[model samples]
Target: MTSLLLYFLLGIISAIIGALPLGAVNLAVIRATTTQTILNAFYIILTAGVGEILLATLALYYNIELSHFFTQHPWVQGSFIFTFFFIGIYLLFIKNKINTKNYPKLHTSKLITGFSLATLNPPVAIYWILAISWIDKYIFELTPHTSFVSLLLFFFGIYLGKTTTLYCYGLWGHKIAQQKNSKTKLSRILGVALIILSIFQGIKFIAE
Candidate 1:
């Protein structure tokens, strides 16, 4: 019981610290909250948390092997590049305004959108690997079972933290939407940001 409590506490702290930084997943959550219901935003955060757990698990168990594989795999790099570009194009070309009253239902389910967006992001996997390495070096010992439990709790904390942050952003968005004709402005800003992220991803891919 003591061991479990310690691990769980560590998990929460680590995940909260890690998630404080802004990133693509954070942006997506904010976007979802702005356009969809808070429940839908939670769905996005839940799936993203699941993705984090999977990545952290893989990092804990097979860090060295996976690192080598990712380094060697051109296809993996290509896939990331293509995915970013595709998403960027899609967002950039989105003509319809994303107002709550007239928000068109997306073809993709929120669950799938959240999962795929989080999972396909190469940085998340790399971040997990690095985070695991740090935890192994500085924190508690990581046996197979302990690593699993700890990371599970950690990602749960991440989900909670992320949800909180996105909800705040959602409220901010809601305020803006209530102002004179701001939904279109918000959508345009998000679209441009995604496009910029895509460009950065492409450059990073080439540099790597």
Candidate 2:
């Protein structure tokens, strides 16, 4: 039981730390919160959490198979490049109405938007594989041979930690959004950060 608890705690700590970085998932959560209500942003958080755990689970059990799949499919990688470049461009220059008076209703299901944001990146699986390997080496020894109950605990902890980290970001966004004068400024800052991040992703693809 103590061993199982360790697995779960490891999952929580790892996820919280992992989600702290500025990336697609947390950016989307921060965007949602800043644009709308904190509660609505949580709709994105819940589904995004689901998507993150799904990717982590696949990577944990099928690291080699997934690695081969990404290598074999050039189109999948191409899509990520296109997506990053497109989003970067859009955010950098696109002018849209910012209605700070009232939160706008999302046309799409917040859940679907969040899930797609989390799941579309194929390389995130690789991150999980690398992260798990590092954790296994220095933190604890986890393997494909790990017991099912422990894996379950770990996954659930991942879900919880991911959402919690995102919620913290949501709170930050809410605080910024609450500032009546900063909506446009926030958009510009987020746009620049996203563009930089996307460029970094492109550079990583080339380097790898």
Candidate with maximal lDDT: 2
Candidate 2 Cα errors over 4 Å, as ranges: 96-106
**Model 1 over residues 1-208: C-alpha lDDT tens digits?**
6766666666556556555544566667766656666677677777876666676677878889878877888577667656656655655566443345666755667777777776776666776777778876787675455655655665566566545554565566666666664656665666676677667866877887
TM-scores vs. true structure, each candidate: 0.69, 0.84
Q: Residues 168-202, candidate 2, lDDT per residue (tens digit)?
A: 98888888888876666676667777677667867
Considering summed lDDT, which 10 consecutive residues are worst modelled in model 1? Answer: 91-100
Q: Which whole-number lDDT from 0 to 100 does residue 15 have in model 2?
A: 81
User: What ranges in model 1 sit over 4 Å off?
Assistant: 1-10, 13-28, 85-108, 143-155, 202-204
TM-score of candidate 1 relative to the true fold: 0.69
Residue 147, candidate 2: how far off, in angstroms?
Answer: 1.1
Q: Which 10 consecutive residues of model 2 have the lowest summed lDDT?
A: 92-101
Rate residue 184 of model 2 by lDDT. 69
Which residue pairs show backbone clashes in model 2?
Answer: none
